[model samples]
Target chain A: MNAPRVIDVRGLRYRYPDGTLALDGVDFHLCAGECVALFGANGSGKTTFALHLNGLLVGEGSVRVCGVPLAASVSAGDLALVRSKVGLVFQDSDDQLFLPTVLEDVAFGPANLGLTPEEAAARAKVALEQTGMAGALHRAPYHLSSGEKRRVALAGVLAMQPEVLVLDEPTTALDPPGQRDLIALLRTLPQAKLLVTHDTSFAAALATRAVFFERGRVAGEGGLPEIVNRFHWSR
Target chain B: MRSAARETWIVERWSRGSSPLHSLDARAKLAALAVYLLAIASTSAWTQAAVAGYAVILSAALAASRLPVPALLARAALILPFSATFALITWLSGDATRALALVEKSFLSGLAVLVVIAATPLTDLARALEAFRVPRSLVLVIQFLYRYLFVVADQAHRMRMAAACRQGIRRNARPRFHAAAGAVGVLFARSWERADGIYRAMAARGFHGTFPALAPTRFRTVDGVFLCGFALAALAVRLML
Candidate 1:
């Protein structure tokens, strides 16, 4: 009868080598099957916080995902496991996509997770279907429209079968229709989601709970509507 | 759907063809071109026949590619300035013949590379670099460059459109060089930030440096014949010269 905490971060602090502070004494927790939005303006440590979730940015505190401590002592093998278990989709689809074809890009994640080519392809197909990008499997990411690229990028991460999704500014360049499709997709994903965004409207639509980030720490946290109204967005 | 359909058509049109030249391994074509280059470089300035023969062979290759001849010509013409620079340097050295030779060699060599590219797909051309002993790192850089150039170009195009929309210029207005420089600076900073995110995505997916081939290439008997035949041809040309 115990609730599962999908992600646990305690006393997180990060400082750049140039002696600039990025994150200071941050603490957070995410539950399984929950959609949480991290809201903040640029340079508000939203990205820095997201990076720590995937072990991309090493910091001074501890992060435990699915009960495994993401400590410095964890081997590269463990990190790979964590990475595969938690997909990190970047803001720019250009950065998320580096392969020649959408299929290849989607296959990249599962292939790296030790899946066979057939298995990877099968997974990629399902992921692309989920994102409504099934027809673009052979198209180059570079050739895709901005909205298509965003969908393809989402598919790339989905193919990894991550238990938790960490998205940075997911709706930044998307059109209204694309944003709706993305929000709908996010609503259906069975995994926990950590969407970092500046779009309060998108945050309002997709997130069940919200965390406000300001100057590198969690400024406030509560239910979605409360945070939105408290932040003074009338909608 | 229209754009997607258009892209699909272009990719298919570029990728599908029935030229004997297209069927040939990229490595063979590249080596042959390299051998021709060496022979052209080694020949006497008076050997216009050799230069002419090189031009004829390259032209035939380009013709065989079935790509638009005008397009190929326009692309080749763009390189004329660099060739002319070499010719000019040779002329200043009091060697008119050497200048002609330099121009001829440069034109032919540059033409050869272009023809090869026109005949072969960029992916095949990249795979062919393996035969040149091109460092894997360099090959990867070139491959990624080719892959991302369109993305960067599209970004630049968008930025230009955005700027134009604000400035009330329809298109292709001559922005000052400093303005262009600022645009480039913005592009670079954006690209660098994107690259950081890309590295994370790549690392998340277990991208080691080596790009894994979707399918393995088989070296069949025909490949062997082509390799041997090209090697023998190069050797004969070397000996004859």
Candidate 2:
């Protein structure tokens, strides 16, 4: 039997305030425990599509996360529920790791979910241990190396206990070893992941399938190698 | 600019150290600070003994914190420039003693704040402020400003370096000034975009309005004793000295 769909987007369309059509008639879905790669050039609406999953950017189209439909006039409570279900790690780790220390940053999401301080800290500790950042819990985020910052950002999202993870350009500022470490780390996570990236090799390593985006629409969807070859995504 | 960031990091490191002053509850320390400031502010300009008393108290607290004394004193001097402007006005108005007192009180107040901040992490201090019923909006603004100041500083530093590389080494002040003005505009725009991105990230993680603390602080017996002792000492100095 096929797995359940964690995210279902049908004809998702979005336009910027300046009249730029970011996402146009895009249809997508992710099954449980599946990792999908979104491949496209810059400004191809990859990040825009990811933003919609958590209701950050409301646009025309239907977005149902974990079978909960995001209505046109979604209430704050509904958005909060959807946000808790979908964790997004932005392209810049600095943008995500705004809290003073690693532990507080990780605990932020859990605490927002109405968890008590002790409960949130416990969840944060587990997430830090999972991300191999337990030792740096008290250290300031700015003092960490680029790799450590990335892990802590991922830990922050993990603490939310989301069913879907949308990571935009996760391997931006890492060396070869950093990229390899991220691939290994991402492989162990159980949530359904959608990675928007330009690195075909990194995508090939973790993505079970790939979708190609062109000018705010899904141009093609297939296996990794096929998508890479069709779009000349490989350097 | 890099030096400023480094200095902030050093202070943050100091806050994390284990010491008697650091162990006190943040709310207690904040109360003590309030008492100390009130004593200093109410002191008469002619009462040099009271000003000296405030300085000694702050120095004792700083020593207890085990932080570098010279470095913190130097940082406290940063307020002199602003205070000096008002002090100069008072001096010109034929109140030299009052002007001296203005500088002295400002410096002592700055040192007292630095002592408290050096002993307690800013996150804990902010939590204490919230516990004291400070408006959530104001507290959030302070938290965000402190958190992002370094990021914005680093961006500005990088922009300066890049502009320097493109402009080359020249003694032309006019062109350099114009370039700097343009860079400021770019920096503002970039910062605005970054702020938007940060808000989006926060919303995605379910941050509605308030920031929640990771660990709730408990006010122990030691904290109560510290608050009472400090407040009594400050009040006695203000009334008697």
Candidate 3:
């Protein structure tokens, strides 16, 4: 018997409003409890691909998040379910943490999941504790350091208790210590993860599998070394 | 940009103070404000003795709250120019008493609101409104707008700095004006994109068009008493004067 796939995609394609093809035909899969690094150059459809997982973009293809199919016209009933199953942390933490206080922002996801305020705050508390951000609960996002903001952003999604976590450029604005802290944090999460990033070293440290994207398609995917060498991704 | 952020930060800090007024339930504070405004609007005497009642009420509230008196007055004064404009029109038309009443009422109303706002955090205020049966949609808009206002201001500041860096200090005035115009258009585009991103982030977290409180509000006996006492006092002043 094989481990069931947490995410399965086939022939995924997407185009922007101006008719620019952001993603071409692509196939991807992630098994239960695996961390996969998605590496690609700028504007190579990495973020676009992540957006599709939560039904944010709804491109041409079949995509299943925890076995829930995301259709061309995603129904409202399914959207909430799909989104609940997949927690997406965007590249910009500012985009994710928009509420006035860190605690409010962290509780946002759980509150949306229909948890009462106390329950949501409790969940946020646990998530913040896990991220080592319990002390900064009342601080605003703008007042936080870049690394702290990133952790808070992750805690916001984690509070929702999703089975699959998708992070786009999780280490964009972090220093060395911050990246190290993030890797340590990611190591402890049990959910399957899809990390979209350009940092090869960061990916090499934690990813179980690595995939390289080029020109809106997956150029190669294998062990981190194999994909990195094949694509000559190192600068 | 720094000043804009600092101003908001200062108010938020003030809102967190442990004053008797701050400790009262937001609903009570709002009710008191309503009664106070009603009294001010209904008063026809326009005499210093009549309006002195309002000054006394406000002075007591301000003293009990332990907030900065000068700062509150400064913020309240922001309403003066607009009210003064209307007052000027009335004065020109020879209704000096009505004009004076307008100016006095406006100033008092502004001061009353500033006191309540200073004592209550914006999040609490929104929650109180929700409990008071204000539409959830309107409250949610207020919540997001308050949260994003600083982000938008920061973005605009960065864009301005970027444009300035390229234009340089040696550039002529005309070219700088054109650069600023172009920068404003770019800011609009970025703001629109940022809004879309924020909406997507909200959706990705199981948002279903309604925001629930993290903790429910409780209206206590003290809050009720404060509401009744304040309202009665305002009525007394209105009727006697």
Highest TM-score scorer: 2
True contacts kept of each: 0.67, 0.88, 0.86
Ten contiguous residues with the weakest lDDT in model 1 chain A = A226-235
The model with the greatest lDDT is 2
- How many residue pairs collide in each prediction? 0, 0, 1
Which of 1 and 3 is the better model by DockQ? 3
Q: What DockQ does predicted model 2 obtain?
A: 0.73
TM-score of 3: 0.89
Q: After best superposition, candidate 2 residue B102: deviation in angstroms? A: 4.3
Each candidate: chain B TM-score: 0.74, 0.87, 0.87
The residue pairs in collision within model 1 are none
The digit string of per-residue lDDT tens for model 2 on B33-76 reads: 99999888877744888877777777778878998889888988
Q: Choose 1 or 2, whichever is better by DockQ.
A: 2
Using all chains and alpha carbons, the TM-scores for the candidates as numbered come to 0.81, 0.91, 0.89
Q: Name every residue pair that clashes in candidate 2.
A: none
| Stretch of 10 with least lDDT, candidate 3 chain B | B208-217
Evaluate residue A110 in candidate 3 and report its C-alpha lDDT on the 0 to 100 scale. 86
Order of quality (lDDT): 2, 3, 1
TM-score of chain A considered alone, across all candidate predictions: 0.95, 0.98, 0.97
